[model samples]
Target: MKPLCLSLLIPAVLFAGATVYNAPAGVEQDKLFQVKVAGQPSFVYSLPVGGMTYFSYTSFARRADIEITVARPVETVAIRPTSYGIRPVINGNVITFRLDRTAQISVEINGDIKHPLLLFANPPESAPPKPGPSGIHYFGAGQVHNVGRITVTSGQLVYIAGGAIVRGSIFMDQARGVHILGRGVLDGSLYKKGESRMIEVNRSSDVDIEGIIVTNSKHWTVPITASDKVTLHNVKLVSDNDWDDGVDVVGSTNVTVDQCFIRTKDDCVAVKAGVQYFTKFNAQRDVSNVVIKRSVLWNGAWGNGLEIGFETRAASIRGVRFLDNDLIHVEGPEGTFSIHNGDRAVISDVIYDNCRVEDSKGLLVDFKILKSRYSKDAERGQIRNIVFRRIRVDQAEMPSILQGFDATHQVGGVVFEDVKTGGRKWTSLADAGIKATHTENVSFK
Candidate 1:
């Protein structure tokens, strides 16, 4: 969108009259021509942020990857690709770029991004966190001034204190019996609009993230893949950006998310499994034994809490519970608490207990089961054994909806208990909290 300026020069000369013109000199070396969008040329910057190098090209060009390494460890550095006569690719601490032609480039080093890059606020590896008089460590130290990708490897009792800001993904891979305890913080405020992921927990087991504050992440706040026995307690996940979610647990088992505060633009908590035709990573592996309790939600720009199976086919989601949680500021212009098998998975034994609602404009719970588009299991099972008990609502405008789009997959055993009314009541199909068709054995208590 921005206009660019190209340098004017004379022809190269040799032997008074014979011409010997080579490549462009100086900034022209790094200067790339015709790298324009629409009609104007744009500039891409190859810079370092949070201990990581990024090769960013302007005008939405196909990404060029390269690596650059810093000789000395400086507190902060900003690398711009336009100045270096090249586009950069960021790999860890290294940044690599390519010059447009054989030319000279100018590089200017500046201090880090005009702010306090808090490194590590938590305790170091050598020091163990001390417990309180009650034998519980409520908080850990704070870390700042680090950038890019952060890898937290195998260790015991790794505690991160609150107020620690992380600009990249927190990679906890292959860690056994890890505990991220205390009232700490993991801040990813910088990547609030970028393409980087906030946290990635892979191949980890028996891990616990409790009593922490994680905010301003772009994608999922906490993502669990191939992990087992994971627990999230009293953690707060909040973001003001679009596509921000509380937690996304995929292909994980025996996971529990309880006593947490979630506020974002996406699902408060979403669970899923892998399918053969519709899966991304491994296939035919379903998620099980997931529980959510005592949590509070502010609002997701889309929906509040959800269980989606758009990719997973014939995937059975079982033993899931949403207990004693609060859903605040839910907008059901469509519906809230959406759980649809998407014509595939058999979502079974899901329970919602003691859920209090402050204000909602959508259905309290939505479960629509149908045949799988990708699976030949035409006899796909129903959304079975789903129950909602002791749900107290201070306000709501929409009735709960339950509908089986087709006859092959029917809804079964749906119950609503102790439903309390709140807010100014309106009457419409859009106003009922429960709307169902071909839903069987459904009851409201």
Candidate 2:
């Protein structure tokens, strides 16, 4: 399916005798456009917005058209590298406009396509940035006595030194190449209602959040969404609020979460494809290639170490590895480390290696086959190629519950090698290790 593109329409105030202009030479041939004002070709699609004109592009299927709202004057609007071939024909067409690397092209509207106009056929800018300290300059909604929230755009680098205490969620929504470094402390204990997050990095790339302490957030504490090449290293998340989750990664890829310490009331680290309520477009959401290694989880009496999928479908989580992590006092139902595939998705190729656990009262590992038995979106499939190596658990009150729904939608190819448990004799390894049923290819070596 073609991604959705917004065709910005010029407001009705700037319709002077506007001029028509065409693109310059050397523009990409694949991307094309046609600009109109009052239903006239007042400006070429390749021309920059010198004034108020409506802009339309392929939304989906190369034929569907969409328009958005824009505000820019003609004189200040300049379209560099102005020419290209005719626009493609498709429906719900969503073209990616990356900065820097993408050749310069301009769109003519009666107005500008806003500040961050989408560049058709251009790749995101990958300019070789100068070397400097890599971190986030946080402007969250908090108080030094009320030093308001900080907003940093994508591709900007700000270093946070150690021992700096700030109150609020650092907004990294539109930022790229963000780095949170040093022994910094982002205190989010007093977050207000309707705030986005303690540290939210969304739609960005090459981000690194490391060696920081995020404490006392009121909501999802540190969430990275729709981003890529992110690293969370040696970070400590202390959530005192009821809804404070440590890390919620949604629609992201190539993330490495290592050597972190978490004590929260919710799941310490949840690898999610996307949430159902907020995300509607399947093309805009996906998460993959994540690794959580050598971390410690604690204090959540009902929290999960690693959980996947909540509500929405269209998820395909692959190449995820959780290795050398330590879990302490991770409390939840028997099926806490739950892999839930709702519909139109498959959660596969996940591995957990050399993970040490402590004080797990509920089931050690549980994989849910269908979202629910009766839901219609339930495309029954197997949880394939899950491997757990050298997982040592200590002190569980009940039996570990690991099961699949049926033979067809069973937990496929679960390899549990060198798995040992220590507990009281009544609920020991022989009795409480695994209570699996309706599974296939489950072997312990």
Clashes of each: 50, 53
Error of 1 at 266 (Å): 0.6
Q: Write the per-residue lDDT of candidate 1 for residues 1-445, one digit (tens) a residue.
A: 1122433243222221111221111212121111221222222211111221011122122322222344434333333212223444544444445432211122222342211111111111223377464323233232343456666656555455432333345667778777775433456655636555566677688887765556567776787776788998766665655656678777788999976767666677777655322124553456789998866665544755655544344367778888877675564353456676654567788887777665566666666665445334444555788876776676544456677867757788776666556633333233444667887776655
The numbered model that scores best in lDDT is 2
In candidate 2, how many Å is residue 423 off?
8.7
Query: Tens digits of per-residue lDDT for model 2 on 45-95?
Result: 221211211222212112212232333223333232222222322223222
List residue ranges in candidate 2 displaced over 4 A: 1-145, 276-284, 334-336, 372-381, 396-398, 423-432
